[model samples]
Target: MSLVDLSWRNVRRNFRLYTIYFISMLVGVVIYFTFSSLMYNEDVVTAIQNKDNYGKIIFIASIIVFLFIVFFILYANSFFMKQRKKEFGMYLLYGMKERQVATMVFFETLFLSAISVSSGILIGGFLSKFFGMVLMNLMNYNDDISFAFPQEAIISTILLFTLLIGIITIQSYLNVRRVQLVELFHAKEKMDKPLKFSMPFAILSILLIVMSYYTITIAGDTNIWNDYFKEALIATTVSLIVGTYLFFRQFSGWVLQKMSQSKNYFKGNKMLWVSSLRFSIRGNTVNFTFNSLISAIVIFAVGFIAVDYAMKGEVVKKEFPNHFAFSTQDDETQKHIDKMMNESHPIIGHETITGIQTEKISNRKTFFSYPEYYTEEFYLFPESQLNAIVDLRGVGEKVDVEGVEAIVLTRGIDEPTKYESHQPEITVLDDNTFHVVEKIRYPLLSIPTNPGGDTGPQPSVLVISDEAFEHVKENRTLSSFEIYQIKDPKTSNDVSRKIYDIVMKTEGAYYSAYIDMYSIDTESSSLILFSVAFFAVIALFALGSVIYFKQLREATEEREHYAILRKIGVGDKEIKRIIRKQLLFVFLPPLILGLLHSWYLLYYTVILVIKDLPSLTTIIFSVMGLYVLTYLIFYVSSTSIYYKIINEKNRR
Candidate 1:
């Protein structure tokens, strides 16, 4: 009878149509609330050693999630408004004023937002603890996280959703006020405009995409990479973006146009779906392009996170082969460290190597310049002591230095010819010189002789024969280091912390404790992996919803056409087949393009850093398989709903 009653009744009648949209909004709210809660969560801040840094990361991720939720809500609202244009027209024909109809629309939005937001916040609060536990478990932490519902989080969620609700209501009101009865009734008949095809633009799109891939693949090998890497990267990204847009806008339409002209266009019901698909693609080109790009990003992100998390241990081990290492001048401090470490954890291997610190080194006529530490002052190690430590770690290449020849150990130099010129002659005390023979990138020590201890680039070490090492050690003031390999060093954070405190107290002391770097990296990487995974899920959810809602809207528009086909002797089976072909055309292209883009992108980027190609491939394909499975679920769901809508109209 009244506007409120009419709005409520319409909502109840159309509840089935709103189910997917409601669920999507509910999940978006839950994700937003859960992540926002973490920003101010006391449990997370207290559990993590660096509270400020953790808060900052969660804050930034929450903002991104919030923006995505806004986009999703607005998108779903547009679909709903389009679907109900006829209903609004009927209301206007029944003596309802435009302002009154707009009010009714506003009430409907308020009702849905109230139900979804309240229920979502309630569910999100309970689920926050589960996500917290997941984060802790991934980080290898054993701390128990208690239930916490931050008031700030609740207030923020309420305020943000309230603002979103206001925006949705305003949009609905404006749309209703501007609609005329004839336009509203005929809105669904306004089909997409035909595409203007051009062969040159289509070919250019393919060429641009190829050029972008070529640039990225050769980025590491070219002088352009060394001089203008940033510019090259920007150019590659721009080209890829433009190329993808053109592929969807021009190339896809051209192919459809060619298909229409071929004999295959009239093949049993092919025209039914093919013609529909052309129109759909023409209208949805921008949407399809965006979905393709987001899908690619999600695929690459998931693969990268999985690979990075898997290879973190190997990376940590390469950087920190020794369980504990420190350089100290005092013998008493070294003894105390050994005693303390031995008391806490059993030392599996230990070595006290003597090193000579000297600045007398010079080079001539080299194509590549070495690091300042390599050319200026550096540590000199005896071949025997280095071999002993190498045996202790059971890794790294041992050097064989003869006479005045020396070996250089460093990393990050890839070109072999850079070290072929006149080798550096290490001049020690009393004018002694050793010619450098071979260069290696193997990491053998933690400290880089810089102020950051083990944080800088791997420092170069000069390895010489025992006879030369002795001569230099006797003449120069020697630096002594105690290296230890302990059992289960990753689980020995407390012991590492105590030892770090002791080592820091000694003046001119440099140390590397495995647990410090390992735990921090583990925690940070796991958090990143979790955040990236959540983002991928959200993006996938958006992609699926976009297609699903779009299909439903089109189905509503084409119901009359299907009814006519049925009356003219078109069987349900043939119509269903047409539906299947039509929906597949919409669903399959972006997914295939996304898969190819991600595979190519990861091959050039993540695979270089993570060299275990086979394992990385397995992980990447596994993620893609899961993505495909999820997408198929949406496809099947959309097809079934579409058929049901058409069947009901045919029966009527």
Candidate 2:
């Protein structure tokens, strides 16, 4: 038979062994292709105002995904090559030339890569449309999306995978040529030892991870956060990654060693299995730690996106209960805005609210001496805001802040502690002295605030009575806002655009007065949410596939070990039990750790965004529950395949 024909036949013959590998590769390709489709989509590009920035982000993220895929493929191929060593050895023993055998590996790789690339592109083409629908939902947008065949994305996928196939082919050729005949025959039986590290280093690894978490939590409390937020982010990010790597590399293996050392723990199948697990060339500490880290990242990425997207909906509902808010000085401007909005949207009703804002004499005073680094500003709403606005919002109820009392509106877990000391005293505008009633969060309205002082609006808003507001109105500049409730929600964009044109093109429109809470139509918000979500999903699938295939690839090497155990008087039942335990041990660490990591992050996100956990807790748990089910499936499938391989000899 021709070498190419033989290789093709071998691929067909080993379809079972190649299934998971093929599936994962296909998934990776689909992810890349789908993303490419979005990246090159013209309609989407023109629609989003932040299109250029999004393109830059996609460019960077795509490179990351590409490099990651290459590494994953190479790593997976290494395990496959190990499994093929015996086959290669037998071929050489039967008088096949090394170059001919290597040529076979090359052909096999090329054929498989072609199948993966082609099928992935075909499937990706169909999925991209469905994905568009999903994106619109996630973004809370109401725009119709038509599916267009993405030629650029298709070409990109083809070229990328084709190049990978070429690289794999060359790698296979080199591997087969260098294979030592004796070593090839002995490869499966050989074991690999975990890397040795000192106790101090292990301790240091734990310390590093703790310190990294501390750095992230303490960032807001530091004076330098305003000036060095970007630097702090970079530093914290590096620390988190390096610390995780170090912990897994040095500390996790040490933990397993300690578990083994326990006299009571190591017995019967446990002793044998634990020893086997710790000593296996395939399940070495490095791979275990690396895969765990990958799984953790998958959890974090997915959770981050889920919470972000979910909270955005909450933000719009709570923060922007009204359709549009236009703050204008001229009553003429108000008329123009009203007409423009009415032309686009049938107005159900509108509210003209007046409030006092002070550029000067609007500072909040703290009672206690503290660090020099607190900048989440507290703003005032006139007493009329409580009876008129806050009453409508139904959040911060009138608390009888008659003369000497003020309530600090707490957002979430993070807000109550903004002050360094407890029971902070506040002197509003330094003239109205009020003892803190209690710090509480009331999401009465969603007005965008710049957290840092770089932006004028403060995050915290307090409500006083109309009497108190009227007293202070003359002291500060009076501003008015016309908040309109529109009947047709989908027409928000049209209304916003008309108002923008009026404010921009019309003569004598004040530069400072502007519209907000309406400018963010569903389409723009949906785009932002879906874009982040898509990146998270792509990362998650890629990482999950890698870990699953990594485990599956090792099953071939495990078969011989099970055979030896059965020969040494271990019953089939006992072997099966041992295998279950072994797999559970390997699976749980990464999965559990990743969940905890994601949980902490999600909580942090809630504090900043929605601030209330009860609102999003169900959704958060549901996403996590889905992940657990998916990862559990991987574990079960891997174990079943491994078990079947170990006992397949009995069937014969």
Candidate 3:
């Protein structure tokens, strides 16, 4: 048969073995094409706004996806070479020239790459339009976004994947060229990798991991040095990656040694299992370590991305309590604001819920303190007005501040100002001291009277009683704010945009203009949402496919051991039981470590930013459950296939 025909037959015969690897390649291409197509989609870019910014981001993301695909394909190529070494050795024994063997590999790689890439691109084309629409709807974009087939996107995707395929094919040929007769037959079984455990390294890894968490927890929104925040972020990431790797390598070996020393692990199947698997575990150390690291990353991405997605809306609501806020209520300006607000209301699919007007009784600075950290802010409103705007629910009984007493408002459950936690007294504008009697963890205003630099005041509004406010006022001119709240805000993107446009046009006329919650969903949150899905796809691809490749490779090397065990009068049931224990050993470490790593990170992160948003935790656990379900599929398949391969009948 011709080289092409031989290669085609090989692929078809081992199609089952090739299924996961093929699907992985296909997924990569699909993600790449979909991202590229969206980048080129006119309607999507236009509707989402930030056309140039989104374009740049999408282009960068597409490049990243392409890189991941190449890495995955190359990794899969290595495994295929090992699995086929015996087959290639057989061909050489049959007098097939080395050149012909390389030719066969080249043909196989090319055929498979071509089929998978083409299929991936085709599917991605259809998905791009659907995803585009979904993204627009997610941001509550009201524009008429039409979908069209992106010819350029298709061309770009095909060219990129084709280049990757060519590189891997050359790789396959190179691998074939290096193989010898002896290597093809016995190379895999000659494995002897030592388990080198370092106590110092393990301890160091733990310290580094803790340091990573500490860095991330502190360098959040409240950090003093904003410029160095990026440095802290990088340090945290590098520390985490290095730490997880070192920990995983040590963890696998450490478990084995402990099992050997302990009586609990010395009895029954544990002894047989642990003793038999020691060398196997040692040889697969790199694989297990990489799997744990990957698992941690996937877990982190899946967990926090869902948390961010859930808590973003709550944050938007807290940080921006009003749908639109205008500092000036000009008859002409208010006319403009009202016209824009009403005209675009239909487009945004929202109706006005309430409009709150507050006359700031002079720029009054409010100061509050905990032990070490003290926050100071400037705001002007009477207790009645402030309480009317913000629903201040106290933990204890709400006593009306009679005379000189004051009530403070702070957003976030992790707030230092929570009534149960803080005794925050306030002094307004540096003179009027009001003994703080109550605290409320509630929504408040975001706009500043003097919106200046990063170090400028991030003041919290103090709601003092009428008597205290009147005494402090002393007949000073006060700034004012008119905020409009809206309902069914998912449909309010257009209205928000309209108000922003009108207010920003005469920029000097207004103190600040922002459409609270939904505005962010359109611009910033859209990108974040897309990123979550992107990371999720990568995680799922790794969890669902890469494990299959690893298991199958190890299974081939382990076939003889299972056959021997079966020959020694081990029943199918007992064999299956052993397989269950073995698979759990393989699956549970990465999973449990991944869970702990993600949980630690998320717990610290949530405490820092979200404070009391329970939904964030709920969403994380929910996503984890789904991830485990998918992971279970890999475990099940690995066990079933391992059992099938090793249960070969002894014919001696």
TM-score of every model versus the real structure: 0.86, 0.71, 0.73
lDDT per residue as tens, model 1, 1-652? 8888988998898887677667777887898988887776677776675555577778888888888888888888888888889988988898888879778877877788778888888888878888888888887776777666788998888899889888887888788878778999999998887777789999988988898889878866778867987998799888888888898888887888888899878989988887887787767777778888889889898888888887886677776777888765367866777777778788899888878777634542231244543434567888998889889989876777788888776644423322347776656665877787776655556632221123543445678999878767764788887788997787677777677777777675767776666777777788788888878877888888898888998898899989888888999899989999899888887888788788778888888766754587788888899889878999999999999988876666
Q: List where candidate 2 sits over 4 angstroms from the true fold.
A: 40-49, 91-100, 146-148, 193-268, 281-283, 301-322, 325-344, 352-481, 488-491, 510-550, 564-573, 597-627
Local accuracy of candidate 2 as per-residue lDDT tens digits, 1-652? 9999998898888887676567667877877777678777666564444455567766776766677678767756766777788999999999999889878887887787889988888887777777766765554455666665578888878888888887887787778778789988987766566556457767887777677667656645666557887887787667666666666666666666776789866477777667666664235445555555655555555555556655555555554564655455367777766776677667776656665443332244442122122224444665555455555544445556666445555333224433334545655554765556555455333343211101123235555555666666665765565655676654354455556555546452222111233223344445554554555455455555555665565556677767787788999789878878877877776667667656656665454556564546776676678667767877787678778877876667
**TM-score sort, best first:** 1, 3, 2
The residue pairs found clashing in candidate 1 are none
TM-score of 3: 0.73
For each candidate, the alpha-carbon lDDT, in order, equals 0.78, 0.62, 0.65
Residue 448's lDDT within candidate 1 is 29
**Better TM-score candidate (2, 3):** 3
Report the poorest 10 consecutive residues by lDDT, candidate 3: 448-457
Which candidate tops TM-score?
Answer: 1
Candidate 3 lDDT, tens digit per residue, 539-564?
A: 55665456667767777777787787
TM-score, model 1 to reference: 0.86
